[model samples]
Target: MDFTRLSSVLTVVGALMLPFAPASAATLTFEDLNSGQASYDVVPSPYKGFAFSGWFYGPDTVYAPASGSIDLFTDYADPTDPGAYVITSNNAITSAVEFVFDGAAFSGYSGVTFELWDAGNLVATSDSLPDSQGAAPYGPTFLASGYSGLVDKVVVSGVQGYFSMDDFTYHAPASNNVPEPGSLALVLFGLGIGGLSARRRR
Candidate 1:
């Protein structure tokens, strides 16, 4: 057997398998929170997976969206004040970060703002709601993609905390120990054994 030709074939096979590698990703819908819960102080809460915190100087609560039965957290009691909610993942999110923000979910008139950040820098900022198209029964959903950076937390702020959000999705930040594609690993293993066999034959 020609070891040189075998090596080239394995190289081609490994390259072809790159796109099939496993991806790291996650999503949060806030649907697990109990309806009508009014504080972040609840221990062992539904948001345990996320380091969730609410930051509103006034009243805040989690309730279902208008015309929909999904739970959302907001401080809509005064649809005229400013408040925010922050959630941090156990690991950083490094790609295709996105979430659903329904500004009108609170009053169908007010808009909200969102900020993505890491431990030190701001990653991205979303526009005020009622998006360019005006408010609808369902608020606007924001999407941030293609950028390459690590974000561990997302802050949602609104004048009066009257906005709603759900379906938080993102690609989890990769770890240093992440493995290569299975096919590539197999190819490498085969190459290592073949190289040893050729050495013995010589």
Candidate 2:
């Protein structure tokens, strides 16, 4: 077998398999919390196999654009405000982050901001949007992260508490342990060629 040809085939096959690999991504729909609960002290809950903390999730979360049922939000009875909140993943989930800001009608909208983090290091931030589109059911602002996966946590702020969010989506990084079927076939073909070349030399 020609070693050079084998190396080349394996490299090519590996590259070709990436797009087919399953990224274990998931979304938090905030549908599990009881509708009557209202607090930021809830224990970490697991959703779609990922555990997350920070922020509050319930029916009080304003209006969800996608689920139209419940959402994750930061707000409470206004005797005192509940400041900025966070949504943290217990695992290193990466890539294709997305969410919706369910803002409501309010006079001085303080805008909404988010910070993506990996291992306590900041990764990316969405430009703070005051949603100047005017209030009275502050038109939901959809946000996506510029950075993908390895982001383990997110700090949500600047909405000043009484705000809503829904459909927190993210993807896990593609695994390197498995080969796609297409790539495996290509590898077998390359091996056959190598075998044939070796046999011809005899």
Candidate 3:
């Protein structure tokens, strides 16, 4: 049996599969929030791959961001005065990371409390971070770190007036326990060839 050849083939297959181990990222730009209808519009539940919660603003309507696009803002329609908006994804976010936004519109004192959750269970939370610290403004980006598991839900609350959310980002792993079809096929092919050669030698 040509063990060396089989080892080399398996190594190549492993290399090809390495890139898939890392999570794939997806971003919700909020550009299509209004469906190109108007500048000011109310966000709906399950818009742009995200499920929203605690949104009572029926027609209060949030205006466009500094970029003049349909973005996410605090809900004033809800009697909850200080509202905490929740956005949850349908899939699991293996790595809950930062987002992009340009905040500080009403005042520089704008702060937010970010909470990360996984399937209704709390995972991690961030201190009240200033709006202008992460991105330019009206942008992100909640910077989260030191989390053991992934999160699919995020809760964000504003300290001052309404803050804008230009975009949000999250990552989803390719597959939890499978090697993917293509990679798996290659590995089986390599083994088959080695097995055939050994059989012929017998």
Candidate 4:
């Protein structure tokens, strides 16, 4: 009947009833692609995390602005271009997409832009690609995260020339995996034992 003891018991009960949280976000780097799929030679048919409507996948060093062998490249050329690229994720709710890009990969290259859409509704967009003018052969890296709302598709577009995007990283919604029935039972049992012990001590 003690107020403090009752408060403690209620807190314990609330904690015990909390559901187990599990990771729900996933990332795709395209490293799983084989040699036949490198250098933008062929699109990764039915790639996981997101579906590709129009895009090129390759290890073209000329596009990726990072050091070492550019293993993968996501080219977002002119919207009018036949090979324009669009990515969509249907398996899970997408949250963010972070990738490296080189706006000046080729001549007439002005800048780049990207957009996030959920169920055909535009949710987020990168209006102007940052003008880093990367040094030497590589361009600058950019990380875009903390997107609001759920995203299902992403579209990358360039101004004049083609924009080279590499290391496409997409984030899915965070979810706490539900604990196994046995695990939950054990946890509940432990909490009950602790609660009984506390009551006896009082």
Name the best candidate (by TM-score).
Answer: 2
Per residue, candidate 2 scores C-alpha lDDT tens digits across 49-141 of 444444555554344345555665454434124443322222132323332222222222345666777666887776665644554545455
Give per-model TM-scores.
0.49, 0.56, 0.53, 0.53
Tens digit per residue, CA lDDT, model 1, 112-163: 5556676556777756555224433334344443345556556655533445
Superposed by TM-score, candidate 2 places the C-alpha of residue 142 at a distance from the truth, in angstroms, of 2.3
RMSD of each: 8.9, 8.8, 8.9, 9.6
Top-lDDT candidate index: 2
Q: Backbone clashes per model, in order?
A: 1, 4, 12, 9
Residue 166 in candidate 3 has what lDDT? 48
Candidate lDDT (C-alpha), each: 0.46, 0.53, 0.49, 0.48
In model 4, which range of ten residues has the least summed lDDT?
A: 99-108
Q: Alpha carbon lDDT of residue 70, candidate 2? A: 62
lDDT of 4 by residue, 1-202 (tens): 5567667867976775554442233444455664644335545555663456545556554445433333333443443464553432221223234322212122123355566676678767654555336443335455453364556666655432244444555433433455678997787688667777888897
Candidate 3 TM-score, C-alpha based: 0.53
- Residue 124, candidate 4: C-alpha displacement in angstroms: 1.9
Could you tell me how far off, in angstroms, the CA of residue 24 lies in candidate 4 after the best superposition? Answer: 6.2
Show model 3 residue runs off by greater than 4 Å.
1-20, 35-39, 54-68, 76-109, 131-142, 145-148, 178-202
Error of 4 at 96 (Å): 16
TM-score order, best first, reads 2, 4, 3, 1
How far residue 179's Cα lies from its native spot in candidate 1, in Å, is: 12
